[model samples]
Target: MTLVIGLVVHRSHHRLFQEAARTLTGVRLEWVDYEAEDEIRARTAGLLDRQRLDGLLLGPVPYARCRDLLPPDLPVTVTRSAGLDLALAWCRALARGWPATPVSIDTFDQETVDEVAAALDLDRERIACLPFDPDQPVAEIVEFHRRFLDRFGGRYVISVRTGVVAAFAGAVPVLSGLAGLGTIRAELHELALRSQSKRASERRFAAGVFLIAKPERSANLDRARIGLMNMLLNTPEYADGWIEDRGRRGVIVFAHQALFEAVTHNWVSLPVLAQAQDTLGVRVVAGFGVGPSARTCVALAERAANRAEQDDSPGAYLIEESGVMIGPMGPAGHPLHFTYRAHGAGIERLAERVGLSPATLSRLAAVERGLDGQAVSPSDLAGSLGITDPSGRRLIRKLSESGLVIPEGSAQVNRKGRPSRLYRLGIGAALAAGATAPAGPGDAAGGDGGRDGDGPVDGGRRDG
Candidate 1:
C-alpha cells in the first residue's frame, strides 16, 4: 500500500516541496497551498473529512496556526530551520558582503537565533532578533520589522516566511529561512512511520461503561450528563469514535482501544475515574474491557461494571483478555475513602505502631476484612500492597518490633526448607499492657495462635 502524506505550504515553496517529493519512493505526497492561517485550518479540516491521508507535514508557521483544528491522533510534522540550512543562509549573506553585526532576524525561535549568532561569532547585543509567531497579524509583524530595521540600522532581512519577505521587498535585502528540502524529507519520513504505528494500534476493539450507583434525590441527572460530556470531549483522545448511551442509570461508551489507553495512560491507578466522579458530583462506577471482538469486549466490560457497582463508592475496574480482574479503585471524594480509618482511632493507632503509612495500612486493613480477623503473611501482604516480597518482609519485621504481630508455632510443608511459621495480629491484653514484641523468630510468648491454611494470611512466611 502506498503511504499518503499531506503537505501544507505557501505558494512560493510549492516547487521546493514538489521537487523533494519526486526524489522519494514507496510514498505518495499530497500538496495543498494556503495563503493565510484561517485558510490552512479550513482546508485541512475539509481534507480530513474527505481524504484518506495518513500523516501531514506543515511549515512551522502553518503548524502553529492550524494545529488546534487538526485531529490529535493524526501524526503531524512541523519543519524547523536546522544545521545545514542555517549554514547555507549564513553563507549567502557573506557572499553578498553583508556585515556580521546588526543582522535583523524574524523567523526562527530563540534557540535557533542564538545558534546562528554563535556560529557566526556576531555580537549578541547588536543582532536584532524577533521570535516567529504565526498568529500575530501581518501588519503587526510588518511594523515589528519596521521598528527592528530602524533600531539596528540593518540593510538586510533574514527569514523563511514569504510574508516577511514581501514586507521587506523594496526596503531591504531578504534571505530565505534556514530549513531546506532535506529537513522536510527527513521529518515527513519520521511522521509516516508514526502514522503507520498509530493505524496498526487502532485495529483492536475496546469498550467501557460508567454506571451511576443510585443518584441522590436532590441531584440533577441532566447536569451530571453535561459534566460528563464536557469532561470526555475536552480530553481529545477519548472524544473521537465514542458512542455514548446516556441512560438514566448509566453512561456506556464504546470506543477504540487507543482511547482506552489514553484515558488510563496504561496505569493501574484510578485518578481519571476519581476526577470524573468528583466533577460530575455523583458516584460513578466504571469498567473497561479490551479484546479482539466488540461483542467479547462488551461482555467483559459488563462483568467489570457489575463488580464496580457492588462496591460502596465509585470504582474503576478493568478485565484484561487474559481473564485477570484488575481493580475496584477508590473514589477520591468518598466518605469512607480510607477503609482503615473508617472505624476510627484504634486502627490509626495500630497503623502508627506498626510504622506503616496510612494508605498502606488502609490496603492491608482491606485484606484483613476478607479474612475475618485473621493474620496476613509477608507474601500475602505484599500481594495486597502491590509490593515486592522483600519489602513485605521488611514491613513484617517492623510490625513484629512494634508488638502488633506475634509469631506462632512453625510447621513443615512437603519437607521443603525451613518450616514457615504462623503469625497473627496481636491486639488483646498483651498489646494493651504495652508488652514488647519478641526479638526474633520463635521468641514470642505464645504457642501457635491458629492452624496453617491456604488463606491470604497463612500459606507463606512466618509472622515474626
Candidate 2:
C-alpha cells in the first residue's frame, strides 16, 4: 500500500522538504503549504478530510498552530533543526561579516546552543537563547529577540520559526536555522516506519469465539449454534470474518485485527453480544483474542470466553497474547480494568520500587511482549492500558525514574506539537531476571488474579 504522508509546511520551506523526500518510494507526500501560521488549521483540516493520510510531517510552528485538529491515532513527526543547522546559520553570519557572538537564538534548546558555542569556542555568556515553546505566541518570540537585542547589542539573530526572520523587517540580520535536508529526511523515514508498523499491527491475525449460555434441556443446542453462526454471517461488520462452528455451543470467527477492531468498536462495546441475546432469545458471550498465530489466538479467545461466561450478563472480553486482559464489555460493563496473573516475589518488589501495582507491572510486561522489542511512546503505552495520554506520560515518568523503561528516541505522531518520546519497556526483561520461576501449569494465568486500577476511568471508550 502507498503510504500517504501529509506534509504541513510553510511555503518558504516547502521546496526544501519536497527535495529531501524526493527519493522516497512507496510513499505519497501530500503538501499543505500555508503563507501564514494562521492558515495552518484550515489547510490541515482540509487535507485530513480529503485524504486518508498514513502519517504527518510538519515543523514546530505548523504543529503548534493545528495540534488540536489532528486525529489521535494518526502518525505525526515534528521536524526540528539540528545543531548542524545552527552551525550553518553561524557560518552564514560570518560569511556576511556579521559577528555570530552575542546573537539571540530561538527555537533550539539551550543545550544545543551551548554545544555549538563550545565547539566553535564562542563565548557562551555572549549568546542569548530563547528555547522553543509551542504555547508561546510568535509575537512573543519576536519580542524576545527584540528585547535581547535592545538589552545587549548582538550581531545577528538565528531562528527556526518561519515568520520570525521576516518579522524583523530586515531591521536586524536574521538567518534561518531551519532543519537541514538530512534531518527532515531522517524524520520522514521514521514516520514512514511507524506508519508501516501500525498498518502491519492492524493486519495481524485475530480470533473471536461466541458461546451461548447453557440452555434448558429441551432447547435444541445445535439449532441455537446454527442460528448464532447465521447471525454472524449475515452481519455486514463480520463480512471479513470467517465464521464457523467451534463446538456444540460455540461459534468462532477468524479475521485480521482491524476487522475485529471495527466490529467491536476497538473493544469498547460488543453490540453483537446484545444483538445475539435479543435475536436468539438466549444469553450469549464473546471473547476476542489477538496473537502471533491462529492457534494462540484461538486459545486466548477460549480463555476470554471463559472469563466472559463468569459474568452474570451477556458480555465480551479481549485477551492478547501479551497477557493483557480487558473484559466485561457489555452495556453493564464498568470502567476498563487491566487484570493479570500475579507474578513472583521479584515482580512484587519491583512494582513496589516503581510505586505501581504488581498487576500494572504485569500488564506492562505483557505490553512489552506484544511490542516484540519495538519502542513505544508514552501515548502508546497509555492506549494499551486504556488510560488518558496525560496519565500515560506520568506513568512513563514514574517508570523512567525507576529505570524500568529505556529512552528509545521519539516519534512525531499526527500533531504539530512535540514529538512523543519513545522507550523500550524494560519491565519484561526485568521480570525475566527477577522472576524466581515461571507460573506453574496448574496456575490459571488468565484468571482475574490481580486487578490494576490504572486503567481508563471512563472504561475503554478512549481509542487504543
Candidate 3:
C-alpha cells in the first residue's frame, strides 16, 4: 500500500520540505501549507477531513497549533533543528563577519547551544538562549530577542521561528536557523518507517482470554461460558474476531491486533468486562496478548488472564510479546501497572532511589530485555512506550542522571541529519545490585510505599 503522509508546513518551509519529501518512495505527500500559525487549525482540519493519512510530519509550531486535531493513532513526527543546524548557522555568521559571541538563539535547547559552543570552542556564557516553548507566544519570543539584543549588544539573532525574522524589521540580522534539508529528509524517512511498522503491527495476531471470575456452580459453568461466547459474538467490536470456548469457564477470541486495540481503547480500558458482569450476573476478567503467532498469543493471553484473576475485581490485563504488562483496566481500575514478571521489589526500590515510578522503570526494563543488550534511541523507546519523542528524550536524561543507562555511541537511521545517541539500559544490573545490597534507611520506610505484587504503581499515564 502506498502511504499517504500529511505534511503540515509553513509557507516559508514548504519548499524545503517538498524537496526533502522528493527522496521518499512509495509515499505520497499531502501538503497543508499555512502562512500563519492561526491558519493551521483550519488547514490541517481540511487536509485530515479530505484525506486519510498514514502518518503526519510537521514542525513544532504547526504541531502546537493543531495537536488537538490530530488523530490519536496517527504517527506524528515533530521536526526540530538539531545541533548540526545550529552549528551551520554559526558558520554562516562567521562567514558574514559577525562575532559568534553576544548572539541570541531561540528555539534550540540550551543543551544544544552549549554543545555547539563547546565543539566550536566559543564562549558559552555570552551565548544567550531562549529554548523552545510551545506555549510561548510569537510576540513574547520576539520581545525576548529584542530584550537580549538590547541588553547584551548581541551581533546577530539566530532563530528557528520564521515569523521572528520578519518581525525584526531589519533592526537586527536574523539568520534563519530552520532545520536544514538533511534533517527534514531524515524525519520524513523516519515517519514513513513508523507508518509502515504501524500497519504491520495492526495485522499481527492477538488473542483474548475471558474467564468467569466467580462461577456460580459446576452445573451452570458451561451455560455461563456459552453465554459469554454469545455476547462476544454479538459484540460489534468483536465482529471480526473468532470467538470460541477456551475452557470450562473461559472463552477466547482471536483477531487482528487492531480490532482488539479498538475494543480495549488502546489497552486503557475494557468495557466488555463490565458489560458481561452487568448482563450475565457473573463477573468476567479478561486478558489480551499480542504476539507474532497464534499459539504464542494464546499462551500469553492465558497467563495474563490468570494474573487478572488474582485481582479482587473484574478487570483486564495485557501482555505484549516484548514482555510489557499493563493491567486492571476497568472503570474502578487503579493506575496502570507496567510490572516486571518477578523482579518487583527490586524495581520499586530502584525507582524510589531514582525518583521515578516503579511502573515506568518496569516498562523500561521490559524494553531493555527485548533489546537483548542492544542500545536504542530515545525515539525508538518513545514509540515502544506510546509517547512523544521529546518525552522519551527527557526520560533518557533522567535515567542517565540516575546512572541507570550507559551511552553507547550513536546510530544514523537515515543517510542525513544528526545521528541519534544510543543507550544500553542498566536496569537489569541495577535490579541485581539492589537485591543483594542491605536495606538502607529509606528502604526501612518502605521506599515510596510501593509493593512487590501485581498491585498498582504510579506514573503510567501516557503523555499528550
Model 2 global lDDT (CA atoms, 0 to 1): 0.77
lDDT of each model, Cα atoms only? 0.63, 0.77, 0.77
For residue 169, what is the lDDT in candidate 1? 84
Using Cα atoms with residue i matched to residue i, what is each candidate's TM-score against the true structure? 0.48, 0.70, 0.61
| TM-score: the better of candidates 2 and 3 | 2
* TM-score of model number 2: 0.70
Off by over 4 Å in 2: 331-464
Given candidate 1, what's the lDDT at residue 459? 24
Q: Model 2 over residues 46-154: C-alpha lDDT tens digits? A: 8887566789999887888888999888899988888999999999999988887889999999999999999999999889899999789889999999888888888
What is residue 196's positional error in candidate 1, in angstroms? 0.9
10 residues in a row with least lDDT, candidate 1 = 445-454
Task: Give the range where candidate 2 is weakest over 10 consecutive residues by summed lDDT.
Answer: 455-464
For model 1, state the Cα shift of residue 268 in Å: 17
In model 3, the Cα lDDT at residue 367 comes to 60
**How well is each residue in 23-119 modelled by candidate 3, as lDDT tens digits?**
7875656799888788989999988875667899998888988999998989999999999999999999999898988898999999999998999
Better of 1 and 2 by lDDT: 2
Clashes of 1: 0
lDDT for position 447 in model 1? 26
Quantify how close model 3 is to the true structure by its C-alpha RMSD in Å: 21.4
